[model samples]
Target: MAEKGMWPVYGHNTAVHLLQRTLPSPLADNSSQRGFGGPRHAYLFVGAQGIGKSTLAQVYAQALLCTEPSDRPCGVCRSCRLIRSGNHPDFRLVAPVNREGAVDRSAGLLRVEQAATIIRDSILSPLEGRYKIFLLQDMQQANESFANKLLKTLEEPPAHVILLLTATERTQLLPTIVSRCQVREMQPIAPTVIEQALGQHWQAEPKQAQLLARLAGGRLGWAVTQLHNAKFDAERQEQLETLWRLAAANRIQRLAFSEQTAAKGSQPQLFNMLEMWTTWWRDVLLAQANCIDACSNIDLREEITRQAAHLSQESVQKYIQTLKRIEGYLHHTTNTRMALDVLLLQLPQIV
Candidate 1:
């Protein structure tokens, strides 16, 4: 399903073509950025989580460092292989790390220590490739204090250092940093495209591939990750059961459930719960509208139909808005307990 020469990136072809054009063209001799022809000092890959921003960034780095005579990043080359194995000498991946020191995307914000390392290394030359690439994932998690530390280097980075950053949105980053980079807003991959990739590229079974494509909701990376997560479907089912139980519970019971989940203090759990609840309500709305085929949670069409039968479309819409509001509000508040309480209080009584 991948185009010849664009092996790794299937969803982000425009960005891939743009990066390929910048590879080692005659115009690359100049150190300054030349529109799409020459590489810029910095690039910001913006998209939702589980999108292929990181993948596209790595592919771009491979092409920049690839030694192949033709089709740069001939993935067989030593540089490409090194990067694929996460052992490339000149390529550095910097992201928020948990207390354990391993990279963790949910670790909240990029730390001052990581910025310091990047600033110190910016002056150094490449160890192997012509360009030293630094991939800074989850820039949205970077606080302004830490982000400002790299402004100087980000503005006028060494000609040999190419900075690649990934974030869900540019608005979350400092305006000064945004101005210093070329922003690539990656688009969502179509379900059909993702399904084909699953069957042809990953050799996934046709039926499973079809189901995953619908569940992924246009996120190929999420679909691909689900392939290796043995407990994915089980976890989804658990959330559905919790949702169904809470839907029929009284106000006190609903509030108690929130307290228990919040007391467990797992951010990923809270995220999954909210996202699953929100999307399921959306499916219910679609089902009520007689658009079950267009629902993202089509695998649970029967459950969605049952929910639609019990709830009025108005109440479903209201709860959907409440979920979306809480989602945005949670980004700014640490008092998740209170937010969840408010959210549960607002939900229409299901039974």
Candidate 2:
């Protein structure tokens, strides 16, 4: 829990607004009553990564723990104070631990031990707050054993306990767990929404904000990351140029260009770059097929048009399918060099 005047920052204003709307009404609320309708337990928030699922969970938890009991958390209340200090006895956070016994900060997976610990703690009454709120971030990372272990408690959670699970991919979770919880799907923030947020928080110039928003693909976290990344602009330009040159060239030159691009970075980085290139190329192919309205890589529209003029629409479509296959294979095999080499060799044939 964060302290007074401190809440986890998020880029999605609509999500914050949604939580504000979902909080129990002023007339029905009691200081001890938490969650919707006096603490009915367990909620699942599902969405894409970096789309504010975890942030929303925290906001809801804060609302549950607020002692003052307004429409939302009164930041100055005793319960809110406790939560902000991370000293709220009723608020338990179950997340994966690392080798050093610290919470694994990266892709924190909830393990059996952590789930057990949460279950053990749930048996007891809250030390201060009205109800116990468990904020489980990244539920998709929880293994079957851990998820199953959670089932019994989740099925019949304590009257004073609430379980809030956040996941980027809900399909990765067991259907049993999904069925027991009130699920809310968090949508990706629109590019315009992201642009407005960036402008408000960062005072970014309109043109720069629009560009960042376009590159972000409706993910504010990614937009923020791009804002901080010194080389993002240059790298995007270079990648676009490389794709254009390869697509426009003769078969031999295209193959040679692919090999050169493939050999430029470390295996993982090279693979990632190729993945981006492939996505951009696919968008170009789509634009060529008169699907320009559906293309995501709109920033490269002009370049796509330039390349599409020289290539047959069918050839571009074939290349797009080949790139999809290459992406699929990259996930399974470790021989990236060989995989990429073969992909590069075949790409020229598509042209």
Candidate 3:
């Protein structure tokens, strides 16, 4: 049970330690009375996806509910056991259900009903532990109604109740709700930390791990996803090589490739491809600027190096700006076919 709060699944040790430091220190005689007078009613953890926000929420919950705490929750205690088995009467995790009205396994957004449940349950006294913990992940996805329902609980929480809400977009949350909680902003993992963690935990092939780490943009979850996504890897490699070849030949192949890639699958996949290309080109830009650390195309560093030799810094900057414009157009939900065509035509002009 105590192991549940150990946050072993997370690779960001520094973030975990930071969160731990926020706990009431056992060494302090007044530690028990610190922060909201021994128990907090609510907290907000703001960070990007895969930055261990959810995991941190759970860890804090464990520390709050742990019967035996020695700097951290003792996994062997009753409170820890209940949390581990997901049978902690005092601990509840509110998340969005799937279309089938089932709890989504993939950490769905919070819905109005889920918020209502938390509100209702939070008003009651804990049946087991001294504290009741509610963990709400992806709070930004909560609709207005859901947010409103949650706000009710935040305004008047029961004794010994704690609400932990996590969001990638903190501003999306209502200001009223934000004002009631202690907000903690989690930083993105550094590339070096991510690289080292991946090597230690996944034992990923060195070259592949390095490339994935760079491409993940300091998101360990995304890096792991890319490592496992064989299809995306194959397609990404193929598309990159095609673009490199066309650029090397100084040909206008952008429109054709964009159209072809857009037609390959759904709009989401097309956007993903566009994002991939953006990152790839950005790496080329960084390489041109002699900013080795800024490059994310480690796997294609050789190709980028070769291309940088012939491409001027101004050209890379122009392409990056063009890509940003294309992204903006996509954000406007521009017609995919037209957007692809226009972006494709503009690609060659940048070169």
Candidate 4:
């Protein structure tokens, strides 16, 4: 059963309601002017990855396509059914692609050729519904040429067409593109809200739900995906165990691990590992402060508390800061080995 005031999306009630108000009433006599003044032709949803931008956009599109008498989407309607099945003729999703035109799995930048293809598609009329929706996922991946290719359509899109773009950050996009659409900034959801949804919808065990909620850092979409990803839990356990072992590792052993990690992994893998390390240290800091309830690694409370007792809170805080700085450098520099070596050397030696 759905919760009170719940629309298809979880959390972000304000965003759902705001979008509902912005849509034209389906009961209105003039259906032809639905996208004219009620909701603008173009919109940009800015937020962190997996924060539900694309999910919300699809729901809003379904509402627009529904033939029902309400402003909201009717799940039973033909249009909504088509959308739910991802077979809607008028809806298109454009994402980043590789050189061969296949969608990139590594989340690369949008290619110029892909932008040209979308421009050609925009000139067409809707095949099955009153409006043609073009959902642009990760517009921040567009380079200069790609962004330029989209300007013509954005400046004066077809009357029957609506453009929806999703980006991790608005600043990553060109100013010209940003100025063309109404911007909607999505914020992080609460852990409690995510926890409740996990149990009710995902049928997760209480402890599993609690752990996922804390690790989610307010992104319900991310949390849900992790539940299904088999490797996620395995990697989490592996990483935590390694850190636990390193707590008592000698200088030679730590340096050996640094060599091995630097030799075997790519820059992206290093980035992810560093993020895990950062979170673990954050838990240690929280444990030191006796903020047990606030710790992300609540399942590892006993280990965290024991470690916290041996480590100074100030040192842990400083190490966290160091990781942040190294992360910034890794993002911009190519000297991966040097950075990883320095990071491992700074690993706190606990008795």
Per-model TM against the reference: 0.94, 0.73, 0.77, 0.88
- Tens digit per residue, CA lDDT, model 3, 39-112: 45788988866667877777677776787765576668888877877788989887667656677634345677
Task: Give the candidate order by descending lDDT.
Answer: 1, 4, 3, 2
Residue 32 in model 3: shift from native, Å?
A: 7.6
Compose the digit string of candidate 1's lDDT tens values, residues 1-351. 567767477777877877776766633553654444678889999998888999889988888888773445788899999998889988999888776667788846788888888988878888877788899999988877679897978877888888999999899999999999989999998989999988888889998788888777678898899887899889988988888888788989989988997788888778877887887888899999999998878678998998799989999999999898988888877888998998988876667
Q: Backbone clashes in each candidate structure, one number apiece?
A: 0, 2, 3, 0
In terms of lDDT, which candidate is stronger, 1 or 2?
A: 1
Pitting candidate 1 against candidate 2, the one with the higher TM-score is 1
Score each candidate by Cα lDDT. 0.84, 0.70, 0.71, 0.82
Model 4 lDDT tens row, 1-351: 234644678877877777777667655423455545566788999998778899888888888888783657887888888888888888888888767778873446787887787888778878877788888888877878989988988998877778899998888889999999989888998988889989999998898898999988788888998888889888888888888787688877888888887787576567767778898899999988889789998888898899899999889998999899998787567777788777777888887
Q: Candidate 4's C-alpha lDDT? A: 0.82
Q: In candidate 3, which residue pairs get closer than 3 Å at backbone N, Cα or C atoms, i.e. clash?
A: 1-80, 1-81, 2-75
Cα lDDT tens digits for candidate 2, 1-351: 122333444444445555555555545633434545454578898886566776678767888677666656766877777766767788876666655667863534577888788889989988876677888988877877789999988887877778889887778789999998878888777778788877888777787788777656566776776677789778877866666566556657755665665566355456546757776767777777888755656666776676666677777777778877886676456556566666665653224
Candidate number achieving the greatest TM-score relative to the actual structure: 1
Candidate 2 vs candidate 4: the lDDT winner is: 4
For model 4, the superposed segments whose C-alpha errors exceed 4 Å read: 1-6, 27-37, 247-259, 262-269, 332-334
How far does residue 212 in candidate 3 sit from its true spot (Å)?
A: 2.3
For model 2, how big is the CA root-mean-square deviation? Answer: 5.6
